[model samples]
Target: MGGMNKIDEPTIERARRGDHRAFAAIYHAFAALVFSVALRISRVWHDAEEITQEVFVNLFRKFSQFGFQSSLKTWLYRIAVNTAINARRSHLREDARRLVYEKTAILREAGPDPAARLQAEEEANALLDLLPQEQRVCIVLRTIEGLSYQEIAEVLEININTVRSRLKRGRETLLAWKQGEPK
Candidate 1:
Protein backbone atom coordinates (compact mmCIF):
# COMPACT_ATOMS: atom_id res chain seq x y z
CA MET A 1 0.00 0.00 0.00
CA GLY A 2 3.00 2.31 0.14
CA GLY A 3 3.59 2.88 -3.55
CA MET A 4 -0.12 2.30 -4.18
CA ASN A 5 -0.97 5.64 -2.60
CA LYS A 6 1.05 7.36 -5.29
CA ILE A 7 -1.63 6.59 -7.84
CA ASP A 8 -3.82 9.68 -7.68
CA GLU A 9 -7.39 10.43 -8.72
CA PRO A 10 -6.27 11.84 -12.03
CA THR A 11 -4.43 8.62 -12.86
CA ILE A 12 -7.45 6.56 -12.00
CA GLU A 13 -9.67 8.82 -14.07
CA ARG A 14 -7.34 8.43 -17.00
CA ALA A 15 -7.28 4.68 -16.68
CA ARG A 16 -11.04 4.61 -16.40
CA ARG A 17 -11.16 6.58 -19.63
CA GLY A 18 -9.12 3.89 -21.39
CA ASP A 19 -5.77 5.62 -21.45
CA HIS A 20 -3.30 2.84 -22.11
CA ARG A 21 -0.39 4.60 -20.45
CA ALA A 22 -2.40 5.25 -17.32
CA PHE A 23 -3.51 1.66 -17.19
CA ALA A 24 0.04 0.43 -17.70
CA ALA A 25 1.24 2.75 -14.99
CA ILE A 26 -1.27 1.37 -12.59
CA TYR A 27 -0.33 -2.16 -13.59
CA HIS A 28 3.33 -1.51 -13.03
CA ALA A 29 2.62 -0.05 -9.64
CA PHE A 30 0.53 -2.91 -8.33
CA ALA A 31 1.29 -6.03 -10.33
CA ALA A 32 3.95 -7.38 -7.97
CA LEU A 33 1.79 -6.90 -4.92
CA VAL A 34 -1.13 -8.58 -6.64
CA PHE A 35 1.04 -11.46 -7.88
CA SER A 36 2.56 -12.07 -4.45
CA VAL A 37 -0.86 -12.19 -2.84
CA ALA A 38 -2.12 -14.52 -5.55
CA LEU A 39 0.92 -16.78 -5.19
CA ARG A 40 0.47 -17.02 -1.45
CA ILE A 41 -3.17 -18.00 -1.81
CA SER A 42 -2.91 -20.28 -4.85
CA ARG A 43 0.37 -22.00 -3.84
CA VAL A 44 1.19 -22.65 -7.50
CA TRP A 45 3.40 -20.29 -9.47
CA HIS A 46 1.67 -20.82 -12.79
CA ASP A 47 -1.77 -20.37 -11.31
CA ALA A 48 -0.63 -17.25 -9.48
CA GLU A 49 0.76 -15.78 -12.73
CA GLU A 50 -2.50 -16.51 -14.52
CA ILE A 51 -4.49 -15.04 -11.67
CA THR A 52 -2.42 -11.86 -11.86
CA GLN A 53 -3.08 -11.52 -15.57
CA GLU A 54 -6.76 -12.24 -15.05
CA VAL A 55 -6.95 -9.61 -12.32
CA PHE A 56 -5.47 -6.90 -14.51
CA VAL A 57 -7.75 -7.84 -17.38
CA ASN A 58 -10.75 -7.66 -15.10
CA LEU A 59 -9.62 -4.34 -13.67
CA PHE A 60 -9.32 -2.90 -17.15
CA ARG A 61 -12.73 -4.17 -18.14
CA LYS A 62 -14.38 -3.01 -14.91
CA PHE A 63 -12.50 0.18 -14.30
CA SER A 64 -15.52 2.34 -14.99
CA GLN A 65 -17.48 0.57 -12.27
CA PHE A 66 -15.09 1.67 -9.56
CA GLY A 67 -16.60 4.36 -7.42
CA PHE A 68 -14.41 6.65 -5.30
CA GLN A 69 -15.98 5.35 -2.12
CA SER A 70 -13.25 2.85 -1.30
CA SER A 71 -9.52 3.30 -1.74
CA LEU A 72 -8.25 1.72 -4.93
CA LYS A 73 -5.84 -0.51 -2.99
CA THR A 74 -8.67 -2.01 -0.97
CA TRP A 75 -10.68 -2.61 -4.14
CA LEU A 76 -7.70 -4.26 -5.80
CA TYR A 77 -7.05 -6.43 -2.73
CA ARG A 78 -10.65 -7.60 -2.74
CA ILE A 79 -10.43 -8.50 -6.40
CA ALA A 80 -7.08 -10.31 -6.01
CA VAL A 81 -8.26 -12.34 -3.00
CA ASN A 82 -11.53 -13.41 -4.60
CA THR A 83 -9.90 -14.23 -7.90
CA ALA A 84 -7.14 -16.28 -6.24
CA ILE A 85 -9.61 -18.21 -4.09
CA ASN A 86 -11.77 -18.99 -7.09
CA ALA A 87 -8.77 -20.11 -9.11
CA ARG A 88 -7.58 -22.34 -6.26
CA ARG A 89 -11.03 -23.92 -5.98
CA SER A 90 -11.22 -24.48 -9.72
CA HIS A 91 -7.73 -25.96 -9.70
CA LEU A 92 -8.65 -28.39 -6.92
CA ARG A 93 -11.71 -29.50 -8.85
CA GLU A 94 -9.66 -29.98 -12.00
CA ASP A 95 -7.03 -31.96 -10.10
CA ALA A 96 -9.71 -34.26 -8.71
CA ARG A 97 -11.04 -34.94 -12.20
CA ARG A 98 -7.54 -35.47 -13.57
CA LEU A 99 -6.71 -37.85 -10.74
CA VAL A 100 -9.72 -40.01 -11.61
CA TYR A 101 -8.52 -40.38 -15.20
CA GLU A 102 -4.76 -40.63 -14.47
CA LYS A 103 -4.69 -43.14 -11.71
CA THR A 104 -1.44 -44.64 -13.00
CA ALA A 105 0.32 -41.35 -13.67
CA ILE A 106 3.59 -41.10 -11.82
CA LEU A 107 4.23 -38.13 -9.62
CA ARG A 108 7.57 -36.33 -9.78
CA GLU A 109 9.44 -35.15 -6.74
CA ALA A 110 11.28 -31.86 -6.45
CA GLY A 111 14.69 -31.72 -8.11
CA PRO A 112 17.41 -33.74 -6.41
CA ASP A 113 19.13 -30.53 -5.30
CA PRO A 114 16.37 -28.10 -4.48
CA ALA A 115 17.37 -25.06 -2.42
CA ALA A 116 16.81 -25.23 1.32
CA ARG A 117 14.86 -21.95 1.30
CA LEU A 118 12.60 -23.25 -1.45
CA GLN A 119 11.98 -26.46 0.47
CA ALA A 120 11.15 -24.55 3.61
CA GLU A 121 8.76 -22.32 1.71
CA GLU A 122 7.04 -25.35 0.18
CA GLU A 123 6.67 -26.90 3.62
CA ALA A 124 5.19 -23.65 4.94
CA ASN A 125 2.75 -23.45 2.08
CA ALA A 126 1.75 -27.04 2.58
CA LEU A 127 0.95 -26.27 6.19
CA LEU A 128 -1.06 -23.26 5.16
CA ASP A 129 -2.98 -25.47 2.77
CA LEU A 130 -4.19 -27.58 5.68
CA LEU A 131 -6.18 -24.69 7.15
CA PRO A 132 -9.71 -24.04 5.92
CA GLN A 133 -9.75 -21.60 3.02
CA GLU A 134 -11.24 -18.77 5.07
CA GLN A 135 -8.66 -19.15 7.79
CA ARG A 136 -5.83 -19.49 5.30
CA VAL A 137 -6.86 -16.30 3.55
CA CYS A 138 -6.96 -14.43 6.82
CA ILE A 139 -3.53 -15.70 7.80
CA VAL A 140 -2.02 -14.88 4.42
CA LEU A 141 -3.35 -11.34 4.41
CA ARG A 142 -2.41 -10.70 8.01
CA THR A 143 1.03 -12.33 8.18
CA ILE A 144 2.48 -12.48 4.67
CA GLU A 145 0.88 -9.32 3.30
CA GLY A 146 1.25 -7.36 6.54
CA LEU A 147 -2.30 -6.10 6.38
CA SER A 148 -3.99 -4.82 9.50
CA TYR A 149 -7.01 -6.63 10.93
CA GLN A 150 -9.24 -3.77 9.89
CA GLU A 151 -7.72 -3.71 6.43
CA ILE A 152 -8.22 -7.44 6.12
CA ALA A 153 -11.82 -7.03 7.22
CA GLU A 154 -12.35 -4.29 4.65
CA VAL A 155 -10.76 -6.34 1.90
CA LEU A 156 -12.66 -9.52 2.75
CA GLU A 157 -15.88 -7.67 3.57
CA ILE A 158 -16.10 -9.36 6.95
CA ASN A 159 -16.56 -7.97 10.43
CA ILE A 160 -13.32 -6.91 12.11
CA ASN A 161 -14.00 -9.30 14.95
CA THR A 162 -14.36 -12.10 12.45
CA VAL A 163 -10.97 -11.16 11.04
CA ARG A 164 -9.44 -11.31 14.50
CA SER A 165 -11.04 -14.65 15.24
CA ARG A 166 -9.96 -16.15 11.93
CA LEU A 167 -6.37 -15.02 12.43
CA LYS A 168 -6.39 -16.37 15.98
CA ARG A 169 -7.69 -19.73 14.85
CA GLY A 170 -5.38 -19.88 11.87
CA ARG A 171 -2.34 -19.16 14.06
CA GLU A 172 -3.38 -21.79 16.56
CA THR A 173 -3.76 -24.34 13.78
CA LEU A 174 -0.33 -23.52 12.32
CA LEU A 175 1.26 -23.72 15.76
CA ALA A 176 -0.34 -27.07 16.42
CA TRP A 177 0.81 -28.29 13.03
CA LYS A 178 4.40 -27.24 13.71
CA GLN A 179 4.30 -28.95 17.08
CA GLY A 180 3.45 -32.30 15.44
CA GLU A 181 -0.05 -32.32 16.92
CA PRO A 182 -3.06 -33.69 15.02
CA LYS A 183 -5.11 -30.93 13.42
Candidate 2:
Protein backbone atom coordinates (compact mmCIF):
# COMPACT_ATOMS: atom_id res chain seq x y z
CA MET A 1 0.00 0.00 0.00
CA GLY A 2 2.57 2.57 1.04
CA GLY A 3 5.97 0.95 0.64
CA MET A 4 6.53 -2.70 -0.25
CA ASN A 5 5.43 -3.75 3.23
CA LYS A 6 2.53 -1.42 3.84
CA ILE A 7 -0.22 -3.33 5.60
CA ASP A 8 -3.39 -2.92 3.62
CA GLU A 9 -6.81 -2.77 5.21
CA PRO A 10 -7.49 -6.27 4.05
CA THR A 11 -4.28 -7.51 5.59
CA ILE A 12 -5.11 -5.80 8.86
CA GLU A 13 -8.51 -7.42 8.77
CA ARG A 14 -6.92 -10.78 8.33
CA ALA A 15 -4.41 -10.04 11.04
CA ARG A 16 -7.35 -9.48 13.28
CA ARG A 17 -8.30 -12.98 12.28
CA GLY A 18 -5.13 -14.30 13.95
CA ASP A 19 -2.96 -14.44 10.88
CA HIS A 20 0.69 -14.82 11.90
CA ARG A 21 2.13 -13.21 8.79
CA ALA A 22 -0.16 -10.25 9.19
CA PHE A 23 0.93 -9.89 12.79
CA ALA A 24 4.56 -9.93 11.72
CA ALA A 25 3.83 -7.32 9.10
CA ILE A 26 2.33 -5.05 11.73
CA TYR A 27 5.25 -5.60 14.08
CA HIS A 28 7.94 -4.96 11.48
CA ALA A 29 6.18 -1.83 10.29
CA PHE A 30 5.99 -0.20 13.69
CA ALA A 31 8.86 -1.57 15.77
CA ALA A 32 11.49 1.03 14.96
CA LEU A 33 9.16 3.96 15.41
CA VAL A 34 7.84 2.62 18.70
CA PHE A 35 11.39 2.11 19.86
CA SER A 36 12.36 5.64 18.91
CA VAL A 37 9.43 7.18 20.74
CA ALA A 38 10.07 5.01 23.75
CA LEU A 39 13.72 5.99 23.68
CA ARG A 40 12.83 9.66 23.69
CA ILE A 41 10.49 9.28 26.62
CA SER A 42 12.65 6.92 28.57
CA ARG A 43 16.00 8.70 27.97
CA VAL A 44 17.84 5.56 29.00
CA TRP A 45 18.22 3.37 25.95
CA HIS A 46 17.86 0.15 27.89
CA ASP A 47 14.58 1.27 29.43
CA ALA A 48 13.35 2.18 26.00
CA GLU A 49 14.26 -1.28 24.73
CA GLU A 50 12.41 -2.88 27.61
CA ILE A 51 9.36 -0.72 27.04
CA THR A 52 9.34 -1.43 23.29
CA GLN A 53 9.57 -5.13 23.90
CA GLU A 54 6.83 -4.96 26.52
CA VAL A 55 4.56 -2.93 24.24
CA PHE A 56 4.92 -5.38 21.36
CA VAL A 57 4.46 -8.33 23.64
CA ASN A 58 1.32 -6.73 25.04
CA LEU A 59 0.18 -5.95 21.51
CA PHE A 60 0.54 -9.56 20.40
CA ARG A 61 -1.02 -10.88 23.57
CA LYS A 62 -3.99 -8.55 23.33
CA PHE A 63 -4.10 -8.42 19.57
CA SER A 64 -7.62 -9.84 19.52
CA GLN A 65 -9.00 -6.80 21.33
CA PHE A 66 -7.80 -4.48 18.60
CA GLY A 67 -10.90 -3.25 16.90
CA PHE A 68 -10.69 -1.02 13.83
CA GLN A 69 -11.48 2.00 15.95
CA SER A 70 -8.13 3.48 15.04
CA SER A 71 -5.20 2.52 12.86
CA LEU A 72 -3.04 -0.22 14.39
CA LYS A 73 -0.07 2.15 14.49
CA THR A 74 -1.91 4.64 16.64
CA TRP A 75 -2.93 1.98 19.12
CA LEU A 76 0.61 0.70 19.38
CA TYR A 77 1.98 4.18 19.90
CA ARG A 78 -0.54 4.73 22.68
CA ILE A 79 0.58 1.56 24.34
CA ALA A 80 4.22 2.61 23.90
CA VAL A 81 3.84 6.04 25.43
CA ASN A 82 1.66 4.74 28.23
CA THR A 83 4.00 1.93 29.08
CA ALA A 84 7.04 4.21 29.01
CA ILE A 85 5.27 6.75 31.20
CA ASN A 86 4.13 4.16 33.65
CA ALA A 87 7.58 2.66 33.85
CA ARG A 88 9.13 6.06 34.39
CA ARG A 89 6.58 6.95 37.02
CA SER A 90 6.97 3.65 38.82
CA HIS A 91 10.73 3.96 38.90
CA LEU A 92 10.83 7.71 39.46
CA ARG A 93 14.07 7.92 37.51
CA GLU A 94 13.92 11.69 37.30
CA ASP A 95 17.64 12.21 37.15
CA ALA A 96 17.98 10.40 33.85
CA ARG A 97 16.09 13.01 31.88
CA ARG A 98 17.63 14.32 28.67
CA LEU A 99 17.42 17.67 26.91
CA VAL A 100 16.53 17.74 23.25
CA TYR A 101 18.72 20.22 21.40
CA GLU A 102 16.96 21.61 18.32
CA LYS A 103 20.21 22.14 16.40
CA THR A 104 21.35 18.56 16.86
CA ALA A 105 17.77 17.64 16.07
CA ILE A 106 17.74 19.78 12.87
CA LEU A 107 21.23 19.18 11.55
CA ARG A 108 19.96 17.75 8.30
CA GLU A 109 20.27 21.11 6.49
CA ALA A 110 22.96 23.77 6.79
CA GLY A 111 22.03 27.13 8.36
CA PRO A 112 23.44 30.66 7.87
CA ASP A 113 24.75 31.60 11.31
CA PRO A 114 26.07 28.84 13.54
CA ALA A 115 26.23 30.99 16.69
CA ALA A 116 22.67 32.29 16.42
CA ARG A 117 21.48 28.83 15.52
CA LEU A 118 23.22 27.41 18.59
CA GLN A 119 21.62 30.04 20.86
CA ALA A 120 18.15 29.37 19.46
CA GLU A 121 18.62 25.67 19.90
CA GLU A 122 19.83 26.16 23.44
CA GLU A 123 16.95 28.48 24.20
CA ALA A 124 14.42 26.06 22.79
CA ASN A 125 15.97 23.29 24.86
CA ALA A 126 15.86 25.51 27.93
CA LEU A 127 12.19 26.27 27.43
CA LEU A 128 11.36 22.63 27.08
CA ASP A 129 13.27 21.92 30.25
CA LEU A 130 10.65 23.57 32.46
CA LEU A 131 7.80 21.25 31.48
CA PRO A 132 6.86 17.92 33.00
CA GLN A 133 6.91 14.63 31.08
CA GLU A 134 3.19 14.68 30.34
CA GLN A 135 3.41 18.22 29.01
CA ARG A 136 6.59 17.49 27.10
CA VAL A 137 5.12 14.42 25.40
CA CYS A 138 2.02 16.33 24.40
CA ILE A 139 4.14 19.11 22.88
CA VAL A 140 6.55 16.67 21.29
CA LEU A 141 3.78 14.63 19.69
CA ARG A 142 1.86 17.65 18.49
CA THR A 143 4.70 19.84 17.23
CA ILE A 144 7.79 17.72 16.73
CA GLU A 145 5.96 14.61 15.53
CA GLY A 146 3.29 16.48 13.52
CA LEU A 147 0.41 14.38 14.76
CA SER A 148 -3.08 15.79 14.31
CA TYR A 149 -5.14 16.36 17.45
CA GLN A 150 -7.41 13.43 16.65
CA GLU A 151 -4.49 11.22 15.86
CA ILE A 152 -2.75 12.22 19.08
CA ALA A 153 -5.93 11.49 21.00
CA GLU A 154 -6.05 8.01 19.53
CA VAL A 155 -2.37 7.43 20.16
CA LEU A 156 -2.59 8.71 23.72
CA GLU A 157 -6.03 7.20 24.31
CA ILE A 158 -7.16 10.58 25.56
CA ASN A 159 -10.30 12.47 24.72
CA ILE A 160 -9.63 14.74 21.74
CA ASN A 161 -10.45 17.79 23.83
CA THR A 162 -8.13 16.57 26.56
CA VAL A 163 -5.38 16.43 23.99
CA ARG A 164 -6.19 20.01 23.00
CA SER A 165 -6.26 21.09 26.64
CA ARG A 166 -2.90 19.51 27.38
CA LEU A 167 -1.42 21.09 24.30
CA LYS A 168 -2.79 24.44 25.38
CA ARG A 169 -1.53 24.07 28.91
CA GLY A 170 1.84 22.92 27.69
CA ARG A 171 2.00 25.83 25.27
CA GLU A 172 0.99 28.27 28.00
CA THR A 173 3.66 26.91 30.29
CA LEU A 174 6.22 27.34 27.55
CA LEU A 175 5.00 30.84 26.75
CA ALA A 176 5.05 31.92 30.35
CA TRP A 177 8.51 30.55 30.76
CA LYS A 178 9.64 32.41 27.66
CA GLN A 179 7.91 35.67 28.57
CA GLY A 180 9.27 35.57 32.09
CA GLU A 181 12.79 35.71 30.66
CA PRO A 182 14.58 38.82 29.31
CA LYS A 183 14.41 39.65 25.60
Report every candidate's CA lDDT.
0.83, 0.73
How many angstroms is residue 12 displaced in model 2 relative to the true structure, after the best TM-score fit? 2.2
For model 1, the superposed segments whose C-alpha errors exceed 4 Å read 3-5, 96-116
What are the root-mean-square deviations of the candidates from the true structure over C-alphas?
5.3, 5.1
Which residues of candidate 2, in runs, are more than 4 Å off? 1-6, 93-129, 179-183
Question: Which digits, one per residue and each the tens of the lDDT, describe model 2 over residues 1-183?
Answer: 014235688877777788889878888888877886776566556677789899988987888898878777777778988998887676565544444333454455587877787676566556655778877777767775667888887787779999888888888887776688532
Q: Specify the highest-TM-score model's number.
A: 1
TM-score of each: 0.86, 0.71
Task: State the lDDT at 2 in candidate 2.
Answer: 19
Model 1, global lDDT: 0.83
Error of 1 at 137 (Å): 0.6
Can you write out model 1's per-residue Cα lDDT over 27-143, one digit (the tens) per residue?
998898898789888877778889999999999999999987788888998999999999989988878432211111112334544455456666767778779999999988888
